[model samples]
Target: MFLTYKDLSELFPNSRGIRDINLPFHTISSFAEQNQPKGLFIPLSEESGELGKAIENGAIGAIWEEGKEIPKYTPNHFPIFITNDIVKGFKEMTKQYMKKIKTSETKNMDMTKFLFLEEKLLNENFKTYDIAVVEENLSLYIEQLSEERRG
Candidate 1:
């Protein structure tokens, strides 16, 4: 599911909002290469250099560590969400979303159930490709449902 910047702020009240860029984002990644224009980036360390580079490459925002001073970049345009416990927060939120998927609907079956079936077909390994495919399908399915509801 997608999470707007405001939703993230609500989920993480302690997180500091930088530049107040309330954009919708999905997926979280630590790798700079994996960072997307609409995804949240969590740097490996509190290094301004890395974070700056990430923003240079189109990373929309970052999840910063709590109480840590932000970098002294010339223009701090990217939004930042500070967290007391980044690992725990990310894990708990991801788990919550997975649970939400279990209850959400799909085209012909429950999203979670269909994912389980797909995993079974793939010998239950549930490789990265399997997860990616499932996520893509579910995203499209959710969007279609939203459009239909609006119509």
Candidate 2:
């Protein structure tokens, strides 16, 4: 999936705003060698100055520990997402991405099935609801409802 730094900031607004590069990254990798051309590099325990290596290898950005010092030699303009807990942040991002995937896959599915899924989702007990999580599903339902009204 393609995501710019702006999109990331929108999804996780706490993140520092970096460039608006339209990098399409699919997965996050720890090792620079394994990083996909547009993927996000997460430097978990790199030696003091290794962030540049990851960026040089084609990572669009790096996610580093919140308090860890950023390498000075690394270009200041490169995007960096800092988190107190990298694993948690990564999992949250993955969950958001997966929802997008599921929604995209079901966009053309039958309305009845989508309705059932929406109902099931509503039945789940959460302390608070996030509308964005179910937005795509609801959009399909709304479209179908509108079409039924017109017909």
Candidate 3:
């Protein structure tokens, strides 16, 4: 969530009387899914239906297609980014966000090994389990990996 309000403003430079947004947004998401509070909402549809949903779900900012009639009820202060191509606007925003994120590769565990780990932990049966403890599970996982390497 490295995105700042300045970044958003730069992404969609054009707007109607929306100079500064009061609340800062942490994430950008579509209108369909309700993200956490303080999200910048982008609609898949040209229709205004999703705009209302965004508002209800606590979207601090929005992207509106340029030349599309702005809704009368929309507050003057609400930051509505105006872009020629709404779809491309959001897509570009997503692309920028993707670049900022750091992704890690994961090893896919075999089902038998997964079941063995589950069995071992189930005996201890803590109500809240965060994959048990790393120290306790590391040896078991290493043993399994060594077997796989041999096979």
lDDT of 3 at 76: 75
TM-score of each: 0.57, 0.58, 0.56
lDDT of each: 0.53, 0.53, 0.53
Candidate 3's C-alpha lDDT?
A: 0.53
Measured on C-alpha atoms, candidate 2 has an lDDT of 0.53
List of clashing residue pairs for candidate 2: none
lDDT of 1 by residue, 1-151 (tens): 3555765675576654464534766544555554355657765333223766666656676777687677787255567777776655554444555655555553343222221223213343322434455565444434443454456
lDDT of 3 by residue, 12-123 (tens): 8786545653345654554424543666666545322466676776766778778877768777777888888766675565445444332412234111011122443335
Worst 10 residues of 2 by lDDT: 109-118
At residue 40, candidate 2 shows an lDDT of 77
> CA RMSD for every model?
12.2, 14.8, 15.5
Model 2, span 1-151: residue lDDT tens: 3444655665455554355646555445555654346657765333213666667766767777788787787666667777776655655554565565555654443211111222323453322224354454444433444454456
| Candidate 3 colliding pairs | none
